[model samples]
Target: MSTYVIGDIQGCRDALLRLLERCRFDPAADRLICAGDLVARGPDSLGTLRFVHGLGTAATAVLGNHDLHLLALAQGFGRARDGLDTVVAADDAETLLEWLSTRPLALHHAATDTLIVHAGVAPQWTVAQTLALAGEAQAVFADRERRRAFLPRMYGDAPARWRDDLTGDDRLRCIVNVLTRARYCSAQGDFEFAEKGSPGAQAGDLMPWFEVPERRSAGTRIVFGHWSTLGRIHWPQANVWGLDTGCVWGGALSALRLEDLHLLEVPCAG
Candidate 1:
């Protein structure tokens, strides 16, 4: 069986299907690992969620910022964004949100040494450490009472760096931001959320998360999305593959075959 790691679907159901066709994905024999943003800002958020959720064990996804937003909105903790009302209004909204809540912030496959996260990992974290930290955030999400209390506090860019001493909301926020929304950050591991352009677009000293010189997880193979402008990156030296191709922005839905590093893509209609 082959594993195909897909970029952010962001509600582009048609593109996802076409890309899967390109890969000849057979649910019976193939597995899909999504780099999050599974729903939002595209043609069919409800349909996308239903399809992905229906995949069950055959598909797994990391939680993207958009996915988390859906969870928060579902809990009445935030305003409804475009393309999300359909989800919140759906009959299966609760079930879908519950599935999303339980989804991991990071997924690591030891055999392929492939780590899938919605965005980037903290410079100070190893793959195992990253998963462990993710579990902390996941725990809050898994518990109904904790999740209700935590969702509102989830929207911020503060404490831009990771510290082992961090506790409570601050620690979980740091972990969530790094795993779901991080892109360029300082060598000191400060997240720069404002700069969303391509790699060279950032100012001095702000490098893509993986390029941080002292990044401890640099040795791990990370399959990530969330930086659409960065497009598809294959840097064997850095052991990072950036898969977001802006499918929601009228670019292409992209996927990478984990076994052979082959890429398959389908143009998006936006």
Candidate 2:
């Protein structure tokens, strides 16, 4: 009953299948946790969604920035690119999207004591706080009425720093950004969304969210995707594991076993 945490995937269903086979995944025994961006930019977004959705109770996924983009496009808020159009036009699009919307932005796996998110947690937030904040945003995405209003207006980078006093859409957006789009941020929790390069590539005081001094979420292991440019799965001394090995960009589709940190990858080269 091993649990494997897979990376972005980004709609590469064939690569995902091969990677799962490499791990010898069994729906009857093993559990799969997807680090998000399950669709977009690959050859089979619709098929990938259906495959994961079909996994039923065996699979769990959090929403990535790309996942939210697809959600917004389905509701006339944004335009599609890559393979998302197929998902939007599918007969079962509504059902698939509904399941996606129900997914939380932050999830805690009790067996591994690992927090799984698309990106990283806010430097100032404790593990419990991260899950609580994620619940707030989850409520909005879960309610159809609020979903209609929020999806269209969800894109933004303002109020880059998080404050406990934040309210309304601003609060929801902040939580979403931290759990989904975050990469580089100041120690004070000010996100630097533009820096997607590896650690040394950034200028100024911004550092990788997990590397921030005295990060409240430290000590507990964090597994995340969304930063393929990061160049490796394990950092020298960090407790976080970066699993996005650029699967959609012609790199390997990667996965890590939670119990032993056993790693494996299957090259797809896009």
Candidate 3:
């Protein structure tokens, strides 16, 4: 049985199917792990969601920022952007919303020491600490009443530092931002969502979360997908793999075989 970690699908179901076929994926025998952004910006959001959802126990996904945005819009917490034109506006949006809400912000595989998160981690957190913090934030979203109130407050940059005293929505927002939207962060661990371009294009003061010297997950193989601009980056010492190759922007869809570290990529149809 093989486990494959795929890059951001971004609703390019055909490209995803081709990559899976090239890998000879058997749903019954193989497991698939998606780095997230399973929908939006491409041709088939609904089909992509259905395909992944159909995988059932064979699949695991970390919630991407796009996925969270879809959830928020479905729940009426925010408006959809013009770029999100491909998302399904159907009655089943509620079902999609529920499934997306249940996804965890991060996943850890003890056997392989592989940690999968949507974006980057807070420089201050160890892998274990990040997992624990993710659980706390996930619990709030899991509860119906709390999630309704929490979604509105989910859109900010308050409580910049991790403080034990931060209560209510402030704390949850920080956790959500770190797990979902993070890319570059200040030395003090403050996230800057505005820097979406390639890593070198950013100001010298900002650093990629994984570049931090004391990153606790340095020993583990960390797989993430949000920064398509980074394309595929391999840090030998860090054991970090970035698979986002900008398929939504007509680039390539990529996947890595976890057991052997083999790469499989397919071009987008446009």
Candidate 4:
């Protein structure tokens, strides 16, 4: 049984299929771990959602920014942005929303020491702490009334630094951003959301989340997507693999074999 970790799909169903074919994936014997961004930007968002959701126990996905955006839009918290073209219209958005809400913000495979999250974690957090925090935020979204109230308060930058004293929505927002949209952070562990380009393009003071020294979870292997411009980075010391190859921007879709750390790439459909 092989387990493959795929990069951001971004709604490119054809590329996903081709990548699976290249890997000779058999659902009966293989498992897939998706880095999320399963919808938006590219064509066939609905198809991508259905295909991945159909995999059931054979596939696991961490929630990405786009996936959360879909949830927020479906729940009437926000509208779709210009570049993000969602395939789900008003009529069929409910099904997609329900499926997306069930996805976790992070996944940990204890046996393999593979920690999967859509983006990076706070520098101060250990893997166990991160998972506990994620569970707290996920609980809000899992509850019907709580989710509605939480979505509005979800968009903010306050509680910039991690504090155990931070309670209520402020704490939840910080957790959400770190697990979803975070790219770079200040040395103090505050998120810097303004920069979306490659790691070095940002100001010298800002460092990619993974670069923060003394990271508590550095011992475990982390697989993440979101910074497509970073392409693929294999860091030996950190046991980190960045798999975002920018399929929505005409780059290839990538997958990493978890058992052997082998890579497989499939060119995106124009």
TM-score of each: 0.97, 0.98, 0.93, 0.94
What is candidate 3's local distance difference test score? Answer: 0.81
Candidate 2, residues 1-270, lDDT tens digits: the string is 999999999999999999999999999999999999999998999999999999999998999999999989998888879878899999999999999999989889898899999998998899999999999998898888999899867888977988999998888888898889999998788998889998898989989998998988897899999999997789747799999999888899999999898998999752
Q: Which TM-score value belongs to model 4?
A: 0.94
Stronger candidate by lDDT (1 vs 3): 1
Question: Poorest 10 consecutive residues of model 3 by lDDT?
Answer: 82-91
Clashes of each: 0, 0, 0, 0
- What local lDDT does model 4 show for residue 172? 90
Report the C-alpha lDDT of model 1 over 95-138, residue by residue, as the tens digit: 98889899999998777889999999999999889999999999
Tell me how candidate 4 scores on lDDT.
Answer: 0.84
Model 4 lDDT per residue over 179-215, tens place: 8888888888988887888767898688888888898
Candidate 4: the clashing residue pairs are none
Query: In model 3, where do residues sit more than 4 Å from their true spots?
Result: 82-88
TM-score of 2: 0.98
Among all windows of ten consecutive residues in candidate 4, which has the lowest summed lDDT?
82-91
Which ranges in model 2 have alpha carbons more than 4 Å from their true place? Answer: none
Badly placed stretches (over 4 Å) of model 1 are none
lDDT of 3 by residue, 1-270 (tens): 998999899889899899999999999999999998998787887788878888888987888878877776766778776345345476676666677778888899766778889888887788898898889877877777878888877887776666657777887888888887788877777777888888788986887888877776677788889898884567666688888999989889989888888988999872
Candidate order, lDDT descending: 2, 1, 4, 3
